[model samples]
Target chain A: MSENSTYAEITEAIRAHDSFILLSHIRPDGDAIGSQLALGHALEAMGKTVHYINEDGLPDNLSFMAESQRIQTPPAEPLDVQVCIALDCATKPRLGENALHAASKAKLWINIDHHISNPAYGDLNHIDSTSPATGQILYQLIKSADMPLPDATRDAIYVAVSTDTGSFQYSNTTAATYEMAADLVRRGLDVGTINAQIYDSNPYRKIELLRSLLNTLQLENDGKVAHWELPYSVKEEYNLKPEDSEDQIDLIRGIDGVVAAAFFEELEDGKIRVSLRAKDDTFNACETAQLFGGGGHARAAGIRMAGPISDAREKVLAAISNAIS
Target chain B: MSENSTYAEITEAIRAHDSFILLSHIRPDGDAIGSQLALGHALEAMGKTVHYINEDGLPDNLSFMAESQRIQTPPAEPLDVQVCIALDCATKPRLGENALHAASKAKLWINIDHHISNPAYGDLNHIDSTSPATGQILYQLIKSADMPLPDATRDAIYVAVSTDTGSFQYSNTTAATYEMAADLVRRGLDVGTINAQIYDSNPYRKIELLRSLLNTLQLENDGKVAHWELPYSVKEEYNLKPEDSEDQIDLIRGIDGVVAAAFFEELEDGKIRVSLRAKDDTFNACETAQLFGGGGHARAAGIRMAGPISDAREKVLAAISNAIS
Candidate 1:
């Protein structure tokens, strides 16, 4: 069976379905939540009942998004739905055990995502690794399927792509991404207010986190590799959530003459979570990460390894240095 | 005479002139230099002779831009040209004395800019304050006037808008901004590489400056106002250039619940330079700046006043607090 599902085929399935439960990954980012809302609201507008569930529920930072409160944690009981759709989750397990149980009653499963590593786990799947964000895929799917474009869908789509692409500054951003933004703005998206909410409103703890991260910054491999570590102590001191450190690695990554930037954090599990970003394909972040049982895209990757923070740092730094040299 | 010049009028003027001189404001930013190159390259592609001049010359960061080397400081002698066009400068004096002398031979002046404060000093002026950046104006002018869009013009336009609009995150960015970016990408723009140069390449000195600034950060007036100071000694200690501190105020300004952010710097001349940003119209930065004989938009403004940096901080912070109250 072919893994890919066309927009028309998905649309037909959607049209046939009377009810739906939508789910995204744990610690949902804008893309994860935005994708669900974008498609969920469109379905709701068409008189289809919809349940928007996530493992972590809505994030405080994303509460400013219009109609964001609709996204809720998995209910105590299962959702009696005809179809279950996973948005932006690369793997089924990422949807979390609670969310999976909540959607267990649905007979049909649909998976739509942009992660390259995503397996076609759903009975019907639309996995487009070429797309920068799943929000974009939903935008196209709804448009092609003649699905109703509600105001929530419009705003959610903008937030989804804008956050994932680093406000269109990342390499994955394409011409289609901008065209979609233009169309959204043309349809009365208040970009100024929305962007301010998405970007400008930051918690004070986030700045403290940056300061702490910068304090630990180091340059290795003749300055080709720049890295910093966050001990578990600092995380407790700053009272930082997972989102507080979001995109903080970009500061080191942006340093001139730096080819690769790595962030090592001591997790509560006594393991180190390492995030790596390469400036170009030459460094191959994924390749370096794979040495430690981690994997990701060429330019960006993630890993988890046993740590007494220093031990993990030594191994990761050496791997990165070897790759750079 | 009416200050506004239509695209047709500018087109006719360009057709009539053979030799031209292009200039932008001193301490030339991306918009300033990018505007000059964009229009200058377009004219050159049309078989018109053009000289691209800036008073202070190019900054180290912008040197990565294609053909950026062409933007040189004024020559010892003025060049004979039919027209002098100033791009992205709010006023004539800001172009610097040397640049004005170099273009003195030109009989006609054309001032095309997006600054709302521009006084329209040119013999022919096309000022659309509604546009977010002068680069956007150039893009539209080139298109409407049927000017050749050379590779330099294409790339220059993107840099100009992207830099000035904070990579299209600023409130001024409109639907047309995204549309223009999409068009440029479609026309063979390598946004990934270009954006990396524009955004990703930051000098280590800039990060040091951030650390220094963060050290002095303070929240006042019940956390509605966030302010910081940069002593001249720190600037000298870091061997910092002015560009090193660019956009650092954004850190404090992004804090949650901060209605305003102020940056106080002790200039080498002993004057205190104050940059103020209001989160919204509730605190009008321009009105506060005007009290110190400075002016700008409601949301962002600047002032240079007598200093002992502390005195300037007290005065500005008081004004901000008063406005918020």
Candidate 2:
């Protein structure tokens, strides 16, 4: 009836719901986990039976999310959730294997997201693309419910908003994001400690993996494209995991001459998982990724190609070259 | 003489000295300028006549040093100073032209530095290699003298100490560094503001220059060595000074496989100045710099080679290869 449902209607639905389940997208990013956990904690504070579940395993870095240890694989039994809430997922399919099926059976599906491409899949969708993250929407929801957020919930929300905005540095950051950050800071959140834990803590093995990757770097297209490949043997030799190599592509992209940087990791299936980063606005790594059936943002993106690392690298470079020209 | 002079003796000498001059090393770094200004402020507090001078012009990034505008070039007039304080010079020659003659003419020469190679060329040398920066030594000197350090002085000292220790991440940092940092933090030094100003703030032109540099990146030796060259025309095109390009070499060195990274800037003097950075403990960039009669720390170093850019690049790569081998 309303252009956008009133806060009162949303509150009424939340109160009427008996059982709530919160879900995030596959390969959950910080915003995904942060929003899921924060909203779940807020609901639990209201004496609601809240279950925070994810189909994909939690990223090791975002393991500090609230009730993170309690997040089990999707229950085998059919869920009877009165309300299903999805955080940070643009499409229903992005809820991955478990939550997608559960959402279909729920009495009412509520989608909370900040993605511009959100499909409004839920019966009650609160999609504010201007918000830095879905966690920002959850903050307002908690306030509307008149529930006091605990420090843990606040920390979860902080991580969600902070990381989504690149610690309040990326182009996505808005004045409202700073207002939210200032409010979070006033609530005695240790921003420095949180930043150090999230962004600065690098293990020795990860540094070694970086060293190994730097050893195989190549420049193409007159040094505009920087590419590197890390073999499975090197990862095994260094005792490094796939997650440990995260952000290595961004580091390469940070080089002064690099407009685009690609890092290829040979998967066990003989496929190569490629990560791409664009340092300039003139190029969009995401568009290149989309060409390979992958999608992401303009500056950062990735795709997986089933082939040898060399073949994958060549294909990605050709795409980038064509795009740039 | 006492095993260690008491606070009273130091205070008496500072109070008694009328004409005080401060000198830092040639190719002065942040620590050198910071130490000189912090000590100058403390000396001025004691009603001493002070003049801060450097031979080479201040690097633009470090132009925020206290009273930096008041710094004078080497004077042709003879100096008859009662007290001459050399802040961060490792050797007398390192003081450059400003204090070359005055250092000999001064009635009392006091050396305050943190360089391990300090020659102790002063009548009273307070060289503590264990300290993080010369500013740390200056902090101790002021505290030992029982002098009240102003907020500005405290801020400058914090900058010096922090920058020299790579924001407390470098190997040179010690337990005392944290203790000093804590003391400064307690004095209401806004670290976030300082860090944002020093590390985060980059001019638009500098960004453009960085973009240009990234366009010329070259990787070799299995990507263990990364190199980029910026001609004088490019710098002029971007309206960038040499100081604006200070961090370019380190950015290249941070590439995944790059054990060594170099940036060759063609100077107006028909010579190419090479800035080098080495990551692993096994490779020392300073050793490579020494091949061209230049010197620096293990991780970062520089050299000036007179030749065409291509020839100089080849020579530098050959020398670095030799050093690593």
Tens digit of lDDT per residue, candidate 2, span A1-325?
Answer: 1134555667788888878988998878788888878878777877888877888767777765556775655776657778898889977877887766755567887878877667788778787877778888888777777776987788889888877765544555554555555566567776556665666555546656665676677778776787888887787788776578876665556555567888899877788888888766768988899899876677677788887888887788899999887
Model 2: colliding residue pairs = A213-B257, A214-B256, A214-B257, A215-B257, A256-B214, A257-B214, A257-B215, A258-B214
- The residue-by-residue lDDT of candidate 1 on A217-323, one tens digit each, is 88887778899989999999989898777678888888999999999999988889999999876699989988998876777888889998899889988888788
lDDT of 2: 0.75
What TM-score does chain A reach in every model?
A: 0.96, 0.89
TM-score of 2: 0.56
Itemize residue pairs with steric clashes in candidate 1: none
lDDT of 2 by residue, B1-325 (tens): 1123344655676777788878998877878888877888877787778888787857666766557765666777646678888888888888886556755567877777778887778767777888879999889888877777987788889779868866654556554665666577667766545654455445546656665676677787777788888998887788887678877676667656678889989998779988889888867989889988889999999888886889989999988787766
Q: Chain A only: give the TM-score of model 1.
A: 0.96
What TM-score results for chain B in every one of the models?
0.84, 0.84
Q: Number of the top candidate by lDDT?
A: 1
